[model samples]
Target: MSTAAAHPAVRTRSLGDRRRRTLAWVGVSLLVVLGVFVAGGVAGDAASTTALADRNLGPSAGHPFGTDPLGRDLLARVLAGLRLSLVVGTTAALVSAVIALVLASAAAVFGGVVDRVVSWLVDLFLALPHLVLLILLAFVFGGGTQAAVLAVALTHWPTLTRVLRGRAREIVTSDHVTVSRQLGHGRGWIARHHLAGHLTGHFLVGAVLLFPHAILHEAALSFLGLGVDPGEPSIGVLLAESMRYLSAGAWWLAVLPGLCLLVVVKLVDTIGENTRALLDPRSAHL
Candidate 1:
């Protein structure tokens, strides 16, 4: 082949290689996060134990993440907090994705008034400030894990719903879909056999992308005292409690947990983005 022809092949190979590397990184990040959660769960009450002698200690050989004002191991506390945060975030994301999928699929498959109503709701929700709405909802729900999850689930669906709705509409109007209808396939049959399969990729990508948002929002709500209960060791709660001690030189209490949360969110976002790129037909060949 000529150099011009070879150039495209080389570019394609480079893109594929980059995607593979991204996938590897995503796997490693997920494993690390999971390990933290597992370790935290296993640690149980160990995270909350206090040893006044170690109070206010900074990072050192024995205490890598240091100790809080109450002398609890910051490392253990952070791990536990991370585990709770991940659980809340994952639950909320799953709930939000399910809501989006149902609304989007119904709107696209049924069309007319259903589509109009869903579209209007999406626009209305999108217009509101997400964090404020989440906080309000969390407060109303009584401020706990359920409240936090519900708040995140309710507020995060609009954008994903819009995306799913568009994709579903396209799928329903495609040649194969029309032929299936012409062949006497019922709506339920067509949905089960055609729409579901076609839209799975979109749903997965949207759900993955929603994970980071859910985590961040949950942490914010907890930090604001409208999320998890005060006694719960969630990332937000950890950060909120650390504020009072910060002025007294317990900086590690907040910094370590905050950094861990940030890293987890970034990793999830990266994984979602790369997954979406890999799944896109147009990008797959490139």
Candidate 2:
């Protein structure tokens, strides 16, 4: 082939390779996260088991993440924390996504009053300081796992709602959707068959993207004593408890677990980004 023809083939191959790598990274990141979630659950009791003899041990072959002041295995504790974080984050994200979906759908389909209300609500939420709003809601809800989930869910929906509303509005105006409306389809039927079907990609991508934020917020709430139960070794709780010991040179107490949390968050965020790229027709081929 001529150089020009060969250049196109090479570019196509490069794009294909890049796409595959992105998909692979997404899959691997997901598996690692899922593994941590499941492993932590399996090691539930071990995370809290105190071992006076092993107290404050640094990273060793047997205790890779070291031991906490209370002599609990740090790795086990971190795993448990991650599991709890995952549960809280996933629940909150799903709830937030559902809220977004419902409000966006209403705004797009009903328009006028409903649209105005949604727009106002989204603006109000966006205007608030996110973390402050979270803390306030969490405090009001009595500061527990449920509170954390609810607060995160309530606070995170506005952005997604706005995005989905725009998409939903476009979908509502599409030929098929208009035809459905003209064919005697009820609002509910049209929503389910047309809007919902079309908006699935946006819904999923938004939910996935919301997860890391949920996890971090949950951790922050716990750190502030407004998150999971005090006794649970959630990442935030672990970090909270490690504060006193940090001055004593046991850096692993806070650093290691915090790093793990960051890693998980990064992984989840990567998965979300890659998934979004794959789903987006604009970028999927590039």
Candidate 3:
């Protein structure tokens, strides 16, 4: 059946399927993320599949990606890393979005000293290098999973807030909004009834787009030793470890996890594209 002719649920599922496939890449990423912590806490510490005897061995049923110099199971490590990466990625994205929404909404609805203060803070954040600032914050704050999550989120909110603030500005000028004001509607009513409806689409699309950034930020931080701590199996951290084994001919240590990260980013980009097509009036025909 034609994509357009399929049942609505099926069509939605199709989109979901694509989204899931894309997210599968994220699943792999999260494995690396989880591996660090999971491996540290597991039995025999066998999380990494590559045994000492099997170090640098090529892909096989017993050791698909082969072992690293440290004799950890690379496959297990990669899987675990996926969980960690996802946790950090998802955590950063959610917290960042919440922060952006609260600040943006308050600034837009109140529009006084609050707006200026928030806008100024946003400008300050925007001026800093996001990844660098995140690393510094993570370093200063602490090294727990939650700390890493907050660090990433704090650095991320400025861009989203800027986007949403602009969107709200556009919405506040509309006729319905103006009429709501004239009709003696309260600030809450104007925000909930008129402003929110229009901004939802834009913000959601922005949120999806932010996913890849969040993932990358978390992975990067972990790699830099500022996010997930040692033994925390993030893909970025794994990639960092793999670099050590690269000179010894253990390629899968990096390749598999890196491939997963790349694919997730692309898939997220695709979803954002499709979402754009669906949400943008100008792109609806496409």
Task: Report the number of clashing residue pairs per model.
Answer: 0, 0, 29
Question: Which lDDT tens digits does candidate 2 get at residues 1-286?
Answer: 7998799899889878888998999999999999998999998999989999989999999999999988999999999999999999999999999999999999998999999999999999999999999999999999999999999999999999999999999988989888888899988898898888889999999999999999999999999999999988899999999999888999999999999999999999999889988888365556
Q: Indicate which candidate wins on lDDT.
A: 2
Order of quality (lDDT): 2, 1, 3
Off by over 4 Å in 3: 1-50, 281-286
Residue 271, model 3: lDDT of 67
lDDT of each: 0.89, 0.94, 0.74
For each candidate, give its TM-score against the true structure: 0.94, 0.95, 0.78
The digit string of per-residue lDDT tens for model 1 on 1-286 reads 8999999999999888987887897788778877978998986687889999888899999989998878888888888888888889889998999999999989988899999999999999999988889988998999988999999999999999999999899989999999999999987887889889988998998998999999999999999999988888888999999998888887888889999999989988877877888788465456
Which run of 10 residues does model 3 get worst, by summed lDDT? 36-45
Off by over 4 Å in 1: 281-286
Single out the weakest 10-residue window by summed lDDT for candidate 2. Answer: 277-286
**What lDDT is obtained when candidate 1 is compared to the true structure?**
0.89
Write the number of the candidate with greater TM-score, choosing between 1 and 2: 2
